[model samples]
Target: MIPLDEARARILAGLAPTGPETVPLAAGWNRVLARPIAARLTQPPADVSAMDGYALRAADAVEGATLRLAGASPAGKPYAGTLGAGEAVRIFTGGFVPAGADSILLQEDATAAEGHVRVNETVMLGRHIRRRGLDFAEGAELLGAGRRLTARDIGLAAAGNHPWLTVHRRPRIGILATGDEIALPGEKLPEGGIVSSNAHALAALVASCGGEASILPIAPDDPAEIAALASSGGFDLLVTTGGASVGEHDLVQKALGRDGFVLDFWQIAMRPGKPLIWGKLGAVPVLGLPGNPVSALVCAVVFLLPALAKLQGLADTATPTLRALAGVDLPANDKRADHLRATLTPGEGGVWIATPAARQDSSMLAVLAGADALVLRAPFAPKLAKGEPVEVIALAALGV
Candidate 1:
């Protein structure tokens, strides 16, 4: 058993970044950029009007000056006439500022009669003009590599004149389960059978972490059948939740070894999840999690999430750590670090008060649903007093 930090570092170090592929801009959202995207054209490209008014030479707008009205210039259409002293062009918002025009006096600010207009207020040069390339210069870097594309990123890409982009391809995960004790959900359970919820939960977990997940049929704890199924290829990662412990029917470890696979870490110093296994089968990374539903999910959040991020060249994910005051006094364990399920409620002083659920058992689903965070209690921690501060991991961060 090792410290949790040491275990995380080891797992991260063994992973590699994913490769890049070109994808249509529409489908690129939530994907990481493979390279910098530079602007292909200048925004606005030319001086344009910022409002519907008259475009005139600012110097000609002397206190009592009146200007002859030129042709109208609406958006997407520009007047051929140029502004001169005592002359103004009728311009609408987004219309090109006619050549020689310096500013615009809104119609509300001037009096119009016949073919001329009167300047009712003083105007400044360069007012109401959107200069060429003011928003973004041509060839400017608009998006950088490793940046996650959001809807906003797509809009930025379109603004940068990019119709498509290169991004990291999502990893494909294969999920398998080994245990005759489990049966598929929605089917009648046999005398000693239980519903197989872990595989579906794992599949959902993989997708939330940005990977494509496929749940294969369960492999009963038969050594020959397990070895054959586990050795089959076609996935970047393999995940199995059962038969990972030291029990006699725990064939996952032996099945991988029988096919010449190298094991990494088999167990860690964590409660309800000490018998986790990780290794490589051929070129695929394999994670054998414990059968306990909550335990499997916790391990997935702790390990699999980081693996997917690593494969996509994403930065190390920061867990949502919150400071909370304990609402109850509790005894402490000395070896395995505990992740106690707790219900959080808003408290005074801008803090959250965490009340550990009464049923801390790993297999209790009803109590887990009511929990919004897992209060992390360190191994060997002394008995905690009520109102003491403790670090909590937000359940939402795990994509629960």
Candidate 2:
């Protein structure tokens, strides 16, 4: 049996990132940028007004000075004529300053009469004026490569005049749940039938990692049937839940072996997910998860998410973890590394307390559902006292 870190490293190293493709700006959110995007044109193309005021020469813009209003200049329409001596043009916000205009006399500080406006406030040169290329200039870098585009990033790209973006393709994953006694949700269950709940969790996890899931039909215990479904289905990676043990009903390994699948390693030193299996079907990575719902999802969080991050070209693929205060007295652990189900609450002095759940049965989905974090326990770890600092991986961080 391999260690968990070795197993995770093997899976991540065996895979390669997907290629890039051109997608419209509307579809670019959360996608990794494959190339740098430069500004298409200078913002504010020319000297424009930032406020509704009068455009005039800086020398003539003074306190108590009255100037004749030449014309009006609204947004998208510039004054055709230039500013002459003692002349002023009524310019609104975003309107061009027109030639020979160097200052803006705010309308709030001025009074308008029959044919001229009076300046009362002290007029400063270049006041209320937005200079050309103030926001960004042409050919300037708006965004760099390998950046994950958020909603704000998408808006910035649009401002740079890019209607389309070159981004990394989303990784494709196929999930297969196996068991003759398993039935789909909303279906009539037999005497011993169990609902296929692992697929939905896997699909959600895949989506959270930016990968699209192809949920295949559930395969029964028949070796031939499972083997046939394990064949290529145009997926970059294949996931299987249940039937990975040495029991007679366990046939996931036997089926994949017939298709030249190379088993990398199995049975990590973990409590719930010890029966896990990992290997490759040609170039596509195959992960065989335990039948227990909690075990399958836990393994997916530990292994599957990192694979998806690497596939998306993320520079840092490590899961986020933090140290917090323990709320209970945890005993010494055995050889197998344990990820104890726990809850986090606020303590005094801005301290976060992690309280381990009393019952951590692998088959209990309710316990896993109620947990907000996993208290990591390494092999041969010593007992922990209440209020002691311990490392915890946030459940919300893994999109649970």
The TM-score of predicted model 1 comes to 0.90
1-400, model 1: which lDDT tens digit per residue? 7766667777777777778989998998888787889999998878888888989999987656898997788998888877777799988988999998989888778888999989898888888888988889899999988777889989989988999898888888888888988888997776798998899988987787678988887898887788788877787778888998899998898877888778988888987688888888878888888998878877776777877777777764545588999989978777888888898998997899999988888887667777898888888898999899988988876677
Worst 10 residues of 1 by lDDT: 311-320
Q: List model 2 lDDT by residue over 1-400, tens digit each.
A: 6778888899899888789999999999989888889999889799999999899888998898899989988999899998898889999999999888999988898999898989888688889899999989999999998787989999889988999999889999999999998987998876789898999889999998789998888899898889888784788889999998889999999988888889988899987799988898887789999999999988888888888888887777787888999899999998888898899998898878999899999888899999999899888899999888999989897777
Q: Which residue pairs come into collision in candidate 2? A: none
lDDT of 1: 0.83
Backbone clash pairs for candidate 1 read: 18-311
lDDT of every model, 2 decimals: 0.83, 0.89
Per-candidate TM-score against the hidden true structure: 0.90, 0.90
lDDT of 2 at 251: 91
Cα shift from native, residue 128, model 2 (Å): 3.6
